[model samples]
Target: MPVEARYALLYSDYEVTPCLRIPFEKFAFLILTLPLCAFIFCIIYSVLFHFESATSTHCHVYNVLPSISAAIGNFSPQREVWQTAIMLQSVPRFYIAVIYLQFHHAMAYPRDAWMGNFAFLLNVTENISLIILSFWTSSRHYTVHEKAFITFILMSEFHMLLTCIMQSRFKRHNRRSLKWKRRLFLTNVSCIILGAYCYMRHNSLCEPYMYSLFAFAEYVVVLTNMAFHTTAYFDFENKDFVLYKYGAAITER
Candidate 1:
């Protein structure tokens, strides 16, 4: 959200960065959104894992449906475990959206540190998702696949929040040097750590195919965000970071 707000300010002809003509804009953005749409679909799929639960999850989902569809696509969560499993992604993602918005607009004003604070609570939001899902699933034993999927997403969100904070701190360093090797190393390291954690947490569980796809999407997005940061001059070294990064920042604008 902050990124969108910033893009509005920065790219608007009336604003800071002014405008630059981008080529193949439509195709490029569609490609970028495809991964995000997949990630979102994975979340909706998780919600489907839990069809019977204490809370309907359906009500909230129904109410939020149009908005979600507008943001991503038509994917919806139908089952209780799916509803429960999905919260692992949906809840923390809300924070990510808000923080991204807050950060984007924050450039126009420094007081938007609220984004940072919101980011710190990522673990809490994720845990809350876990608690709700666990309680719901415990009512009826969840599949090992569901359990592992939940574990992977929860861990990814926790780690993504860490990456957000770390990246923000790098920006604070003034230069925010663009070193693909450095960035890729850190991101891959994050992936390895998250994979290892998931392995440790659910060694007995059967890994879901959906979760593998989700992990792949998340890995790609980490690289995408780096590309985004490079374009925003949120990083120092000017490289030809893929234009797809700007697509994300531009969406909510």
Candidate 2:
């Protein structure tokens, strides 16, 4: 019998519940694609509006890359587009949090289980802080926005570190999984280095060049995160999960 058919036969009394217990790969794909699409749309909109030329002064032509925040903030013509991107990205962020939480719960390793929980906490914190920072633009709530931005960055880095540690543990246990984990670790390191360089050069004397670098670095950061989650597809590809309602009895398959 097929796996699904056999499982169905074993639990004839149970009805399949409609829930978000989707395949890890599918969930990860959505998490990666949605934000990417949103950012691409925001970038195109910003360019079409000539946001930089509109804001440039006598001697200073604003570079669009470093000015992403400014482009999305109150004064920019593409503020609405930026906010829309934020809103769209928030959906994937929420999905990622839930998916990872479920992933960790399902694969509860006795020794390093807490690492997964900690990573999930940081992930949630980063996403919440990002949403808060996006809505409370620096123009109106500068202090609050700055705090949220700093919190988001800190949490994101810590989350990535924890995830790397977790993947390392997996690699030690299952040699077959090492390939993706190795790639993920490299990507994480690259994100950290690029992020540091972007930070150091953000407001330097060569503003335009630094801003462009910052923009590209930020894109790499996002792509690195997408790659990290994409590895989960391989990690959990063969595992099957059956979720039960609260207080309902679960029969082991």
Candidate 3:
């Protein structure tokens, strides 16, 4: 799609998906307001601890920590990282919604050509879980109880990046079938084991060791996932360009 044409979604006459053609008037309002909504979600999420600080006198076992523990829940530098992560997280969800609207259009018009709605759904679910994990790990006690979650996040990161690489490299092939999904599940479980190792050797009692390790592991995970997915996207768009150019609409697995 042309750059102008892609942005023309707010005013264009193209079909929302392969199916139903949508008027810009119908979705323009929602689409126009999404950035605002994402901003709000980030603001609220960033200050969740600050929001709770007024009520946290108990200092439960989960709140042991040295000094930063008292500040983890606030909008400090530590909190800012999650603010960014959670906000970026919304991009995938927004894309998911765009695909969903197209799905609705396709059902209405009966001409949609996008493949693997299930795969798209899986993609959305993974991103949602990822964002949640990011926020949860920001908690002061998250390391104590759920360090394993980071391992799972790393596992998914590698899995999705590899999946994207595979898809991009072999666009004409059917690669992610039953065996692939099983392999993914097994690999993800192993990630949890890596987390266990990290925890057993943990130095969480220190000033910033806890957050440093947590952030380090998560930074690598997010960067790898995002970069691979972004590259795969261009590959996908290019493939779609070719398919559209050649009038090749039907694909079967």
Best-fitting candidate, measured by TM-score?
2
Clashing pairs in 2: none
The candidate with the higher lDDT, 1 or 2, is 2
Ranking by TM-score: 2, 3, 1
RMSD to the hidden true structure, all candidates: 16.4, 5.9, 11.6
**Which is the leading candidate under lDDT?**
2
Off by over 4 Å in 3: 1-81, 96-115, 134-196, 203-215, 236-253
The local distance difference test score of each candidate is 0.39, 0.61, 0.39
Question: Least accurate stretch of 10 residues (summed lDDT) in model 3?
Answer: 244-253
Looking at candidate 2, the ten consecutive residues that score lowest on lDDT are 244-253
lDDT of 3: 0.39
Residue-level error in angstroms, candidate 2, position 47: 2.2
The digit string of per-residue lDDT tens for model 2 on 107-157 reads 557687788789889988988887787789876898998899889778877
Error of 3 at 62 (Å): 20
